[model samples]
Target: MNRHISPDGYRVDGPAGQDDETGADLPAIVGRNLRRLRTRQGHSLDRLAKLSGVSRAMLGQIETGKSAPTISLLWKVATALGVPFASLLTVEKQAGTVVLRRDRSKVLASSEGRFTSRALFPFDSERQVEFYELRVAPFHREDAHAHAPGTRENLIVAKGAIEILVGQHAPVELTEGDAILFEADVPHGYRNSSHGEAVLYLVMTYVETVG
Candidate 1:
């Protein structure tokens, strides 16, 4: 953990990662990835829409680059796909140098630009876990759908305050230097309850598929 983060201090907001070798736009990249993954899994728009809790129209929009999905929506899609959350957000391989870099990492942001997650490692079939630097804007909440069974999420608060709610349990509060780990197989979210942005290190573990 070299802590490679956004260069712009705290307000790192954007959509679906950085430019790969191709320099494609965020919508195009996400749409292409989503379409490929859905078809590979042999899921149709109607079926995937029902499974993901997103409307078939919206799914069609996302698959056609006509819309940009929020973090929550993307999470739903990934969960339905039985893959890591970054599967649809990632369009290109991260350039390697043994250590991660801000430029090399793929950063995915909410459609509203309130939440951003920067992937700290390259995704591959052999990897069972994914790590990220998460940034949440003031008063923003990113609600994520449940992951595949046996998935867990670990969060370490680096700055500001956050309220985390997993499943239907009570919301847990965390401040600077505090960490919380919980089963991510249920619905979960991160909320910035304070006026400042909440920065955290998030680790996602998957079993048999991604842990």
Candidate 2:
């Protein structure tokens, strides 16, 4: 793999066999990268562990590759690191760069059949904005969720109807083709109040400070 630096100087390593390794080696790689990035951002392990709601021990294990993380674990770590979950893994090498078909895109289903979110890009950049396709079943409501500092969300309704509540504002109704952009810090919730399912496209942007 040819390791290069992004414009921001963060390392970007993509090549075959990066995500494949025998035994605990994978975690070690992930841990190393996580620690390096965390340090670069001036975040102590304790602070990161606290912010991510993950145990320091578990994070250590992930950094050391002693424990392979589940999807939820990955989610926590990625959220803590302020990166995308897939950013932790190395991409497989391919000749001629064959692309994976849309059917092969990884899918994340909501625990309750209420909705589904599909990631649109790899989540590895130190300061990356994420894009997702959200599907909300009829009459579904999501518990309030908040993002980190400076995180912002832009949601566009593609089909059906959606009701969004941000902070103290009254729930706003959105029909197909309508869009709203807002800061994500305040508690927020979403509901599909229409008779049919609703489809929404969401963009999540992360803000980072560099000295």
| Most lDDT-accurate candidate | 1
RMSD of each: 6.1, 8.6
lDDT of 1 by residue, 1-211 (tens): 1122222222223334344432565566779889988998899999999998999999998889877666667768887888777676564464545465576555666535688888777543225688889999998998777787888989999999999999889999999999999998988889999999999999989775542
Clashing pairs in 2: 16-93, 27-65, 28-64, 28-65, 31-63, 84-123
lDDT digits (tens) for residues 1-211 of candidate 2: 4332222222322343534221223446566767776787798878988988878897787677566554455556666766644456533333453443354344455534466676665432433567888888999886445655677889999999999989888989999999999887667888999999999999987674421
TM-score of 2: 0.67
Strongest candidate by TM-score: 1
Q: Score each candidate by Cα lDDT.
A: 0.75, 0.66
Deviating ranges (above 4 Å) for candidate 2: 1-33, 39-44, 64-100, 123-127, 209-211
Worst 10 residues of 1 by lDDT: 1-10
